[model samples]
Target: MIDASLPEKLKEKISSFSDYKIFTHKNPDGDALGSVLALKRILEFENKSSEIFVFNSIGAHFYFLPGIEEIRIQKEFKDGANSPALFVLVDCASWGRTGFPFFDFAKKEVIAIDHHPKRTDKEPLALEIIDLSASSAAEIIFALARELNWKIDPEISFCLLAGILSDTGAFKHSNTTPKALKAVSALMKNGVNIKKIADNLFRKNEFPGQLKLLGEVLARASLEPRIRMAFSFAADKDMKRHGAEEEDLSGLANLLSGIPESRFSMLLIETGAGKIKASLRSETHKGVDVSKIARLFGGGGHKLAAGFEIEGKIEERFEMIKEKIAKESASWRI
Candidate 1:
């Protein structure tokens, strides 16, 4: 949970910053992108100049966002002696995710604004503002803007709304708090099209994407009959054969979680050459914590929605994981 006294620290930084650069996680999700843009808009309203860096074609989905034209890639320009003096990392915990090329140069002046649960102070971070209870990092930004009474333009609202909608899977996830709803209500009031955003995010899909989804559900899927849970996996080859993209698989993991009698659901996709990307959900199971499993495999997420990756031949190692998960399932109860 983020400390209530966090605002005082944010205020202190705002008072001192002349110029800053905003960064987000690699493959930046909607929440990550939205947080960066929302923060930039707020600072701009205060006449504080800033720049945003979106890495790995994160800006490719520009149509969904408001001011996509202004977002830049850090590698395209040089950071000189007088360039941005501060770096703001949004929706990212560790430094590796922050796409800023000059991270070592900007380490002392970086600020981390995220909403993931934490156990302790991650060493070497300058300013940390995290509140897992808030749902989206955008929600935290909303609270910060209100605390500072900063002007939130319609564009800012759009950014924040994008973050909120994306992270909560359009309010399907458990993290959607009352405060999140209230923040979204304000964004809607500020002219964000809730319908359009939801449609673009959830409904829009090309033929290839549709085929990818169909193939995944029809072929790759498996059901743990004992737990009433269904799962599936898509290897890089599967994606290539169906002309698939990562965006196409973004929420496909949730499909199996809807089983009528399910206690839990999961999915694993081979995203990397030697890595098996996983999605573990607690659906109706209360006795298991996927986070513990994820930690064992060098990944992390919430108890209800955790993920991990394993190294080796995707098919060969998957059986080992399934056996381990079955053992864990034996100890599980609704």
Candidate 2:
């Protein structure tokens, strides 16, 4: 069931601010893009003006989503210490997750809308409409709209559905819940094209470079027998050689997680600037909580899916991951 109080509190908080800025994690996925876009539309529906901001580039696979062009890209957020507008973080809560840990939130009011597990760090600045049981942040956004009696347009419907589809892996992941499916059914009733969403997300839009990169990464995949973990890495050189972007690595971790012998899977990509992006996935049925592993490195997400970034060479990070898994595996049920 949706929390009755959250929407009311959000409505109250939003009324206090005339302008808003929406943010999501860096290297955003479908859910991050979806939820942020949908919320922008929702705010408009409420007659509230808002803008979307994100760090780095978004994947081409998501170029088909509505309102894709409006999102302002930034290398980092400028100081907002004196800004009066409220900041709404979708899909992730912590500033570190947004890839800007030092962003000034000193006296700024903030709201966090996410489906991930609660963070152990400092709490949100204002309202937090978080549902750990939600399949995706898009699902939470849809419920939020329903709770507040806000009308969802066709564009907003597509955005929400795209997020739900992206995070649920087209309803294939274990996180696919009845409520999520019901939400999809309701969104489709608004005349959104599910085929277009599916084709772009999974099949039709894949470019030659992305395919080559996938094959190369798959060939290098290594499975640790003792821990039942499948791991792989894509060097920055390889990414450049194939012309593949960060978004192309989206589903690779989930693919590795499909190995029957593996309880969890991880994909590490060297994303230049001495930084490595680690995407982690676990078999929920196997009781492997990858988020715990992510938290140890200052990242967080759902138990079955989480990620973090590190500063170093890929080899060193790979060794660190292996060691963390070896030590952490003793606590998880195989």
lDDT of each: 0.74, 0.85
TM-score of 2: 0.92
Lowest summed lDDT across 10 adjacent residues in model 1 is found at: 98-107
Off by over 4 Å in 2: none
Model 1 score (lDDT): 0.74
Candidate 1 ranges beyond 4 A from true positions = 59-62, 74-84, 99-107, 119-122, 224-229, 260-262, 284-287, 324-334
RMSD of 2: 2.1
Clashing pairs in 1: none
Give the best candidate by lDDT.
2
The TM-scores, one per candidate, come to 0.85, 0.92
lDDT for each residue of candidate 2 in 170-222, tens digit (9 for 90 to 100): 99888799999999999999999998998888775568999999999999998
